[model samples]
Target: MPQTDLSPISAAPGAAVLHDVLIIGGGLVGASLAIALDRLGLEVGLVEATAPGALPAVFDERNLSFAEATVNALTALGVMQKLRAPTGAIERIHVSRAGDFGRSVLEAAKYGRSEFGRIVVARDFGEALEARLAELARLRRYRPMRFLGLADGGSDTRAVRVADVDGERVLHTRLLVAADGTRSGVREALGIGVDEHDYAQTLFVTRLRSERAPDGTAYERFGADGPTALLPRGDRSFGLVHGVARAEADAVAALDEAAFLARVQTAFGWRVGRFLGCGPRSAYALTRVLAQALTAPRAVLVGNAAQTIHPIGAQGFNLGLRDALTLAELIENARRETNGAGFDCGDTAVLAQYAARRREDRGRTVAFSDGLARFTANELPLLRPLRSLGLFAADRLPSAQAYLVGAAMGYRGDVPALCRGGTQPGALA
Candidate 1:
């Protein structure tokens, strides 16, 4: 992403730069939204806190599981074609619980899919986003800028105060978006409260090479402590997410490479061959953060600022991308309806429609992630039989398998047009 180095003229009291839509964050979701709106004939501005040539913490070494719908949306936005790194295909998923007799398997071939989705390293995806953003014809990027707070504005627009290297200035916009992480300043400025839940678990992510290269099958094994997942990667290694009790996380992290591999092998069993080499592990505390409302006045929330869910089902970024695409679709429709005569992007009806369209998808995704995280953590003996039976039913019954497949592929309510299979960039249908 190329950022302008010229110092911007400080706006006088009544003179301010205005945008059709101003996004507060430039992370994964925010950047995606900026790219979507770029093709829609809107004057867009992106506030990125990170300076040029430096990657944000969100683009760490962790691996991201993209649902099929997410893959389609990114491809449609021309982001996937810019990726420098190859992605791993998930052709099959195997799910089971420790000390249980039942197991479930989902195959993409059975559902007429070449693969459920592709897995990309977060760092690689971030680089792809930058490449795509650089190609946008009309996106204004404010790098190394900090959003101060909401400023005074008329009823039709919102005034946002921000500080850059030069100085502080106010920018006006018809729509304000909060794509910042779990703790969002824009949401706070809008007086939108959040509901939080701590899972009391620490997730460790890393990569491991086995005697056998991954055959495009992902494994999810749940134990009393937590769930351990291994996702296939393009480099002939498996991306690992291991969950452990918060109290025991440090000890697990301090283990020697051999010891760590052994523990994972014991927990996950020898589905693949023995682990040969392991990479450095990174730990993150698991928590679910949900905004009380999706919109307030002329502003709205997307990505983690809207809802941060457990990573058990690998639904965090996939759901957030859906949020971004849905909003972009709605804004595109509004612009077309007015024949480019300049309609209100922040009109109450537009925000209400966006909120209503997102409710079912967001609520169901949160419930699935949160419920799975809690359900697998409980080891009550009385629930053991129920768990086994549920797994059996899910594996045997067609309806249950179909539901799981739908969730896995992100075919939820009100999917955006660009999220459909084979959608081209800038397509309306």
Candidate 2:
């Protein structure tokens, strides 16, 4: 596809400048959306509050499980090939209670796939994506920009006001995509309300050099305290997500390397053997935030702007990626049908169609994540047997296991053409 050149709008007052899409926030979700839209030959502008190259690189930690579907999307976008190292293929995943003998194991063999998915470090993933973004000629990147508000009462186009460290400016576009993080200005400006539920827990994430090689096996262990995860990374290290009460998060964060390693060893048991060493630790609050509505007149929200789910299943980023791809597909279809004219990509019809397409998958994921968090955290003795039975059943039923795996991998309900490794019939050249 040929790149769209977007010259800067003249500074003259009342000058009309336009883009096919204006994306707020340039994190992974926003950036990915920019690339995807550009691939469809749409003129896109990305505004980011942070400066270029500002993403954090803590250690060999913070691994993400990219569903096969997600991998396919990234591969089609030409980002996956630039990964620093080969991904750790997750052939299997095991979920169980710390003291319970019953467990649910999901394997790729039964699904007729080489692997359920793959795990990659956050830093490497970010690097590969950024590199791909650099090569895209159609994407316009505006850094250090803060979204102010949106112009109301427009049917075909919307104006977005943003400010950088230097000054404020206005941008006009047919479609405005809010890919900003949890606290999104576009979502707020659109009068969109979010239903938020706090888990009242904090997640401490870090990297550990384990005595045993992970061998592409991911483990999730639920205890009375909270859920702890061991996600495989390159080498012999593992990414750790240790959930604890909010009160204990600070103390845990303050622990020295040895003390922290001791605590992790006790909490996670010997499944991965002793933690030989630990890296820097970070903490984040666990909460679920779902936007009551994803779209308004000439705008729509994607990524964290639309919803923020708990990290129990590492679904936050994966879901955000899916949102980007799905929106791209919808816009590409509309653009092709209109021959790149007359159709407002952000019109109510388009926005509504996008929302309707996303409703079921988003609703189910939020419910599943919220329910799983609540179930694992619940100390009620009466629910223990039910939880055990559910796990045992999930283990025994191949169909059930495949369903869960497919959902986790972003393959449920009307997957996008690119995700299915197929091209849309009328996709832009």
In terms of lDDT, which candidate is strongest? 1
> How displaced is residue 206 in candidate 2, in Å?
0.9
Task: Go through the candidates in order and give each one's C-alpha lDDT.
Answer: 0.87, 0.79
What is the TM-score of each predicted model, taking all chains together?
Answer: 0.96, 0.93
Question: Which regions in candidate 1 have their CA more than 4 angstroms from the true location?
Answer: 1-15, 422-429
For residues 1-429, could you state the per-residue lDDT of candidate 1 as single tens digits?
Answer: 443522233434546677889999989999999998887767788888998787778998798999999898898889999989888999998999998779999999999999999889999999999888888777888888899999888887899998887778888899999998899999999999999998889999998899889899999999877789999988889999998989999999999999999999998989998999888899999889999999989899999999999998788999998898888888878767777675878988889999999999999989988888788778888888888998898898999999888999988888888888645435233
Which ranges in model 2 have alpha carbons more than 4 Å from their true place?
Answer: 1-7, 10-15, 56-61, 424-429
**Candidate 2 C-alpha lDDT tens digits along 294-325:** 99878889888999998877777778887888
Q: Which candidate is the best by TM-score?
A: 1
Where does candidate 2 clash, by residue pair?
none
